[model samples]
Structures are given as structure tokens and as C-alpha cells.
Target: MHNLRRIRKHLGITQKALGDGIGCTQGNVYHYERGQTLLPEMAGRLIAYAARDFGLVLTYDHIYGSAQLPPVAMAEVVNRG
Candidate 1:
């Protein structure tokens, strides 16, 4: 299972909100959370959105369930940008 759902919930981002930020629909986000593989373009968009909109950085491992996220400070994320 992808960690999209967990990441979103961890950041307190609603599906609709995340979808909107990434230029997709809530249904698409729902499907992605449920196990659909995200296309490269969509994955890139999602990564960009997390950083730009929420000051959160995300990696492929976080999205694909290969690794767990460490506690990240917003200040560090913003500074990295």
C-alpha cells in the first residue's frame, strides 16, 4: 500500500485540498491512496505541491511506502526551497 493516505493525514491535508493543489480531483487522490500507482507527472506535481503549499518535503519512498517519514520541521523544509 502506498503511504499517500498516511502522508496526507499526517500533514492534515484533505484529499480535495491536496488534489486541488496538485491539479487533480479528489477522486483521483482517493484512488491513489487506495493503491493506484501514480504517474510520474502526477508524482512530481504532488511533491511540488507538498513543498510549495505546505512547506513539507516528500520523497518517492514516502509516497510509495518504501520508507517512513521522519519528523520534519516546517522551517527546515522552507529553507531547503
Candidate 2:
């Protein structure tokens, strides 16, 4: 579950419009925005769209509610730092 609603609102778009952009139903967008369920593909598409159109980096954690990195990715990031 994620706070997609907040993002959508921030972008001044309706649920139906976001759904249309994401290829989901308005009901699905409503539920997803309410943190009921969010598909990864949808999340990815949303992030890409936001980045491309609005220059926003809406991260999966920001939307999906889990910002925790996997151990391997975290380790790699840490090593680089």
C-alpha cells in the first residue's frame, strides 16, 4: 500500500486520469491510492511518467510504503559510499 493519492493530488490529476495513464481502472486507482494494493509495474510506470513529465522521482518506497532496500543492493550502495 502506498500514498499514491497524495502524489496524484499533488500533480492535480484525478484518479480516473491517473488510471487511464497507468492502464488501470478508476476503481483500481482509487484502491491503489488508498494503499490497498499496488502492482510493481504500475508503480514503475508511474515513476517513469512522473520523472519524464514532471521531473519528479517518485520512488517505490514513497509510493509502495516500503523504502527498505534489499540486502545486496544496500550492500552495493554502501560499498560505493
Q: What are the RMSDs of all candidates, in order?
A: 4.5, 10.6
TM-scores for the candidates: 0.77, 0.68
The TM-score of candidate 1 is: 0.77
Put down candidate 2 lDDT per residue, 1-81, tens digits, no spaces. 577887776666678877776778899987776667677888898888666655556787867675532222233223323
Maximum-TM-score candidate = 1
What C-alpha lDDT do the candidate models reach, one value each? 0.77, 0.68
Candidate with top lDDT is 1
Q: Number of clashes in every candidate structure? A: 0, 0
Model 2 is weakest, by summed lDDT over 10 consecutive residues, at 69-78
**Candidate 2 TM-score over all chains jointly:** 0.68
Query: Where does the lowest 10-residue lDDT sum fall in candidate 1?
Result: 72-81
Tens-digit lDDT track of model 1 for 15-68? 988788789999999999888988878878878987776667788878876776
Model 2: colliding residue pairs: none
Positional deviation of 23 in candidate 2, in angstroms?
1.5
